[model samples]
Target chain A: MVSRGRPRDMQVDERVLRIAAALMLERGYAGLSIDEVAEQAGAAKTTLYRRWPTKDHLAVAVVARLQADDEIADTGDIRADLVNYLEKIAAGLNRMRAAGHRQGPSAGTVGELVAAAARHEDIGRLTREQYAERNALALALIERARVRGELRADLDAEALFDQMAGALYYRVMITGAPVDRAYAERLVSSALEGNLTCH
Target chain B: MVSRGRPRDMQVDERVLRIAAALMLERGYAGLSIDEVAEQAGAAKTTLYRRWPTKDHLAVAVVARLQADDEIADTGDIRADLVNYLEKIAAGLNRMRAAGHRQGPSAGTVGELVAAAARHEDIGRLTREQYAERNALALALIERARVRGELRADLDAEALFDQMAGALYYRVMITGAPVDRAYAERLVSSALEGNLTCH
Candidate 1:
């Protein structure tokens, strides 16, 4: 009948993640150590380990916190709403692209997190679940647009979203290209305005 | 005018890579060791080191070979050509999806190679260059389509290609979904056919 965890426990969780995030931003995935985080957060190593069994777990938590602001907006105008959502995603990717003091077009911490997911089965499943949840929201927004006659009745909503989001990721991970508001706008336009010449 | 290297040297390179590829496909990234490769290849350790310098280098080389078959084919029909090229890319991704004896929707060796590129500056640069070259070829195809009026005169060629390829990579790395010819067709259709209602 009571709360799951004491308010005191919640405070400790916040403080530890804050410290861990700082270390990771300053150094990187390699520089993040549970020992250092525990020492800095003034929390016992066992408490941190109990909550996050591995560095990858903690790193994923940090990224989740960073991406907490990526809420999709549906303004009836699908193009405007899509640009806004994609911009939020770009902002998040840019933040991670610079993590670990990396410069240039390197994927930086993002790449390492991806590898971490591959290295651990649990992490992989957890990340895929999170992405699916996020994608479902976007798809629903697209569906609403379709119902309102803003989009074609037979639109491939899944492919539509994947193309936009995937382009951002492709640039960051593969091309080392810059992803920004301009790129987001371009992606939305290309996606919405079919490439085939109109009859 | 002289050859860059003798035929024997080329043969050794091929033999070593073939063996290395087998080990990587069987054991994944962690299991691919230069020492083991050299031992199995019956080549000197120094020779392998001189050529690849690190395990990341060797792994990258192995993937490049695996992807050698992904040559872009432009048969003049932009729609058909795009679907064909995307199918080739999807096939490559599917192969990597199952590397290291992995099951289910895991990214498998593909994720590890991405991390490997991020971990080393040289590898990152090399891989980016390779992607740029391949991207240029795709872009050229799109340009030809535009020139021939197959696509909109004002189409965002870069964005178009990025969306299609990005969707494939996104499914493999982010969503852990199957990327096959069927999905490739869906992506191409969604990309070419405007999503807007007939006003």
Candidate 2:
């Protein structure tokens, strides 16, 4: 519940997060440690503890940064805007999939993150809130399009958004399939247009 | 690559799986152990290992049995059929969500199973294949409807199926939302009719 704002020493936080991110991406979740990160970032253990408190918390912060506030564009063309937003999400998933890497189909790091959330109740709640926050932005975008007559008035926006986003997650985490921009386009098309033949 | 079929002792396999499922559901995945299940089921350790190979394999068998053979019903109505299938999937997810007896928002056992698949290459491949098998059934059903002119001939079948199923998973795993029959109906409607207004 504490505010994750910038500390008095802003540069220290940035340096620590950058180093932490690099460590996680290069060596995987098990390889990430505060002591090692401190040694590399030239920051004291106390500062790291004061900020992150635990390894899982630190990992959450690192991922938060990776998500880089992808500004959603509402160019009135809902389809194009949705595609762009989904592409950003695909890019993030691809980055995680590439992290710690794998010869297997599974995205190991993404699984770790999901497990981390399950392991720690705090992490689970935090991640859920983060998802809800992101989902809210998307829902609002859909609502705007509906108001402007770009989409169906009776559309189940929540279900629509969930389907689009869920497909990407399912592919990355379960199927071990690729989630690139091309896949995002395909997802957008399938979700926006009905699969049923017009009666 | 071994066939998960019957051995010389059919009853032994069923008994072991039943106990394992109970242990997993009552005590959770962490509490379900080979030694304990072996002792309780009065089966030799070698027998269990030969059949399951690993705890993950046993767990997979338990889930497979729980899923049963949900006979897909196609009464010349694709929407009703898809809803029935999605509801079955949702029921499985809800059962798993209730497993480990955790009242927390996260489905801990489901998360563990996913991570287990990620950690072990064999498990990952096995689960992927199982999912593929299930997906194939759904795809064939869709193709039948398409042939009958019920659905669009050029519909992105894979994407449509993925979106509907993925949304259920995303809700259960990530958002911790309830995925009941009503939700399945909503998903089917959204996916079939889509969000785009009629031209």
Candidate 3:
């Protein structure tokens, strides 16, 4: 019986995360509750706790699901590859922006998540680890491109990555600007091609 | 007597802001209060209220003063100018980072100020305007360099500015990384020369 019920756990997780994500989007971070999610998902409170441990953890899981683990590509053309990678990041930011908080020029859910990470040590560690892993992948992509002479040999790879990616986050959080494909293209172009005057 | 007291009012404004900034940096944003600052500075609550209108407004003023109205220098060398601008930004971030959130890797007052901006429309507008003004100056500096053939003619000025400045903000707000003089140099290098390999 236990063997037969193994897949159902996965099903429950899927349902809970789906319902939780929806609740968060509809009402912002303040509206999402584990009890509500459990009731809505038709799962017991124990089942939810066994997986997420805390609401922050559940929020992390929801975001993790939204994050792209498959977007880092090795298309050989570093410019195109960087643009493609940034487009995925921009799409994710746009989705977060769309999730409610529709009234003001605020990055609602994303702001709350940052606050949440600050509040809990474990949650902060886990979320930071996730970003680190993603950055590692991006860095590896850059490294490969460099090896093939597609990028500058002495390039400060970390700073390069930070500028391209940071611009997207800055627009989303600080300026309340929309991070679209066009914006992504502009960012990649500005970053890949130097802004200095040629000799 | 009141006509003679105009300069005294300026002194009170300076005192109140100084004490408020200290309190905010020492106790974080939640611990900062108009009443406490007024009392500490031996001023009346009515006086503070007449000046700032709200705590958020006062906080905005404190930050405005701390921000470098003196950082936008045009030395004709775009690379060096940008680096100097970014270094000033980093120094401010480092100060905020040191404002006693040593317990955790959180952006402490900076994050709270951002949330406060979101919570109040007036604060958000005022803060955004301050940034806009600073950005205009920086953009002008970049434009001058471009016109004088110190920078690329076809460059995306806004994107270039965003990439350089946004990286500093991104590190402070999201990545919990230290933005320093060295980091500023790296950012300028990456943005100016770009990451693309020479053809």
lDDT per residue for candidate 1 within B80-185, as digits (tens), equals 8999999999988877778778889888888888888888999999999999988899999999999999999999989999999999988888889899888889
Candidate 3 displacement at residue B8 in angstroms: 6.4
Model 1: CA > 4 A from native: A1-5, B1-5
In model 3, the runs with Cα more than 4 Å from the true position are A1-12, A43-57, A101-104, B1-13, B43-58, B68-70, B101-104
Q: What share of the true interface contacts does candidate 1 keep?
A: 0.77
RMSD of each: 1.7, 3.7, 3.0
* lDDT string, candidate 1, A40-100, tens digits: 9999999999999999999988887777778998889999999999999998888887887
Interface RMSD per candidate (angstroms) = 0.7, 0.9, 1.5
Question: What DockQ results do all the predictions give, each relative to the true complex?
Answer: 0.84, 0.74, 0.59
Candidate chain B TM-scores, in order: 0.94, 0.91, 0.91
TM-score of candidate 1 against the unseen true structure: 0.96
Each model's backbone clash number: 0, 0, 0
Scanning candidate 1 chain A in windows of ten residues, the lowest lDDT window is: A60-69
lDDT of 2 at B123: 81
Q: Which CAPRI category fits model 2?
A: medium
**Looking at model 1 chain B, which ten-residue stretch has the lowest summed lDDT?**
B93-102
Please give the ranking of all candidate structures by DockQ, highest first, separated by commas. Answer: 1, 2, 3
lDDT of 3 by residue, B61-125 (tens): 88888884557888888888988989998888766655644455666667666766655667766
